[model samples]
Target: MADIAVSTRGLVKIYSNTVKALDGVSINVNHGEIFAVLGPNGAGKTTLMRILTTQLRPTSGEAYVLGYNVVSDGDKVRRFIGYVPQEFSVWTDLSGYENLLIYAKIYGVPRHEINERINEVLRFMDLSDASKRLVRTYSGGMIRRLEIATALLIEPEILFLDEPTIGLDPAARKMVWDKLTALNKELGLTIFFNSHYMDEVEMYADRLVILNKGKVVVEGAADELKRSVGGEVVELTVDDMSKTVHRVNEMNSLGIRDVNIDNDRGIVRVIVDNAEEALPVIITTLRDAGVRIIKASISRPTLDDVFLKYVGGKISEEGRLQEVRTLRSVIKKG
Candidate 1:
């Protein structure tokens, strides 16, 4: 129990008697490790985060953070945990230092230590120079770092983030992640987060759980999850997609693992036990069936592939457009 930073058992959340936001979800996050929660829109990612952060109560079951029950000991839990939500929660009208001051007051940081703590987090998050600037003038990534700085004012043991790098460009995302990685390494903070970006999750998370329709679909390290998919992906565009799919599916001894079609692009994706050994056989099979191969490529399964295998679709194809637009609107004014 001492090694576990957070644990949940049979957690459930229901809204309005009709929607079950979480259904019997259970997971364990080890101390000082980076954990990720992944899901499509309406998959209860936020609902779970709200519960763990003591913002929302679970309809059933239990969640424990750092030995404190989130529901019964909400205050104690709050003292040891910090949360950054999906939306821009900072005050854009105020300077970054002012925002931190307000959060410091809310978190009840000692009066004598408030300024020092603010300066420390500002420097730690690389925001010291921008500390006096109104948050509206900061870039999207800077605003996000400020939000993180606000959370860190409490010096909590665990940090929870929902969509930590959403809407930022690649460089901004990289910067945010670099800081987070440093936090994990330097402070040994248990970082639990929800993200729609599978690549980032694969890159940073120590372990992850994929939730869909309020249930846990799969949970493991990214590499373990990808290995579970058990094959290399052979993506090719053929002149005759329908025929290629048919030919590949009809061959039983081809050691093929799965087949899928991209109707819009006319690409047929074949999964096999080994691409190096199977690519030639696949090309030969297609050619004999009078299918013209326009292009072909082979790659190892990715986290997206692991997600689609279990969740039925790529999370990238799901919602989050409006959130990005809102953040972009904020950044445009900066």
Candidate 2:
């Protein structure tokens, strides 16, 4: 087995002369590692996924999946990788067992191994009881797991999952993550998947590739990415009659990460590299400026802070992390 499972150099893909699905993209996924590509909708994640699965050809540049060129050796490449598409690709009318049997036969899985593989995967998914149930009758989350189990039937060397838990509830999402982790760690399988949930990725990915507008923004360990945020946010409530703008700029000039204000609420949000060193300074600075401070504190930089820096940063939106909002602006709490 190769140390690098997938490698791309200056990969480019264009369609309809107006959209750049993937452009100048380069990335590496190490063998036996879980690499996650996370991005919002229409950010070219699907484009890259399609190309990697050898279903679509790139406009230019080169990509290799499992030592086989994605374009030239697509058949060989497809054999070694199993992909669970975002859409439900299995036959809903068929039972889980029937669906897996058809795929195994199509993949040329040896007849002797088919029964064992199907049984093993069904048990692995904790869906042995539902093996005979119609896929259409299964819940959204259970169907998702069945899809993954179908991919695992081939015992593929590399697995690619796209938004595997998109519509799943918390418990099902966690069960899927736990299964992926077991496969990646205990079984030493290389898994490449895409998702928008920071909490989910933070749990499973050994490394991450973040994409924005058909381009990769950053790739690194989660801790290092979070460390880049540096410090905590000091949320200050100001009751000054007229000194808000002057105060916000003054705080921003201190090499602080950012400054945001809820003008409607008189709260100034400050991001600093070192919260301990900066929070007292801000409190004293504002007091010295004759501004009254209602409150001040320091905290941790969450995964959304990282997302806001990389994904939302490209769109020029205020990284206001609240709870349970749109996927692009994830719900990050203080």
Candidate 3:
């Protein structure tokens, strides 16, 4: 337990009307590693983070941070952890420096050291140049960095971020992750963040758990999880997806493990023991059936594939439409 930064067992949170935000979640986050919680919105990612950060209490089960129980040692837990909630946290009316100062005060940073801490975090987050600019005037990425800067003012051992890069552009998202990677390497800070971005999780997370309907679906290293799906994928876009699927099923020698259809894209993604052996057979079978293949490619399974295998569908953007709007508003000013 000494080396473990965060741990939870059988954690549960129930809202009014018997909505279970989290159900029997248990996980361990090692010190000095980047961990990710991934799921579609309302999957209880925020609930679990809130419980560990002491922002909300679990109805049952246990959660600990830095060897201290979150319930019994909320203050101690708060001292050792920095949290950036999913909603907008900074005051858009205020300059970035003023925003940090307010948080430094709220977090009880000593008066004498507050300025130095603010400067340090601003520099670390690469927001020193925009320190005097109003948050409303900054780009979406700048505001996000400032929020992270505020979280760091306390110099916590672990950082908890809820969808830290949710609505940023590709370059902006990469920049944010670059900063986080540096934080983990340079400060040995444990980072636990929730995201719906499969590619980001695949690239950055040392380990991750996928939650669905308030329960953990699967957890492990991304590559290991992908391999667990047990096959390469031969993805095809055909004029008649239904016909292609029907044709593929008749080829028993291909040893196809599973077939997933993206009806929206007219794609049939087949998991097979060997794409090299199965591709030719699948193509010929489809051609003989008069199913026109518009596109086809063979590639190793990805985190998305792993997600589909476990969660039974692709990740959805159902609950994040508002966040997207807010991000657009912030970016419009810049």
Q: Which consecutive 10 residues in model 2 have the weakest lDDT in total?
A: 316-325
RMSD of each: 5.4, 6.7, 5.6
lDDT of 1 by residue, 1-334 (tens): 4999999999999765546678999999999999999887777899999999999999999999998999899999999888999999999999999999999998999999999999999999999999999999999999999999999999989999999998999999999999999999999999999987889999999999998877899999998998888779999998888788888999788688888775545678788888888889889888888888999999899887787678655343443454345445666666
What is residue 196's positional error in candidate 1, in angstroms?
0.8
lDDT of 2 by residue, 1-334 (tens): 6899999999998764445678799999999989899877666787898999998899998999988999989989978888999988899999999999999999899999999999999999889999998998998878988999989877889999988888889998888888888988888889999888888888788889888767898998778887886577766777873475467566665668766554445566577877778877787887888888887766687666677666655352232221113332332321
User: Candidate 2: how large is its RMSD?
Assistant: 6.7
| Cα error of candidate 1 at position 149, Å | 0.4
lDDT leaderboard ranking? 1, 3, 2
Those runs of model 1 whose alpha carbons end farther than 4 Å from true positions after fitting are: 239-243, 250-254, 262-266, 314-334
Candidate 2: C-alpha lDDT: 0.81
Mind giving the per-residue lDDT tens digits that candidate 3 earns over 115-168? 999999999999999999889999998888899999999898999999999889
Q: What is the C-alpha lDDT of each candidate?
A: 0.88, 0.81, 0.88
C-alpha RMSD between model 1 and the true structure: 5.4
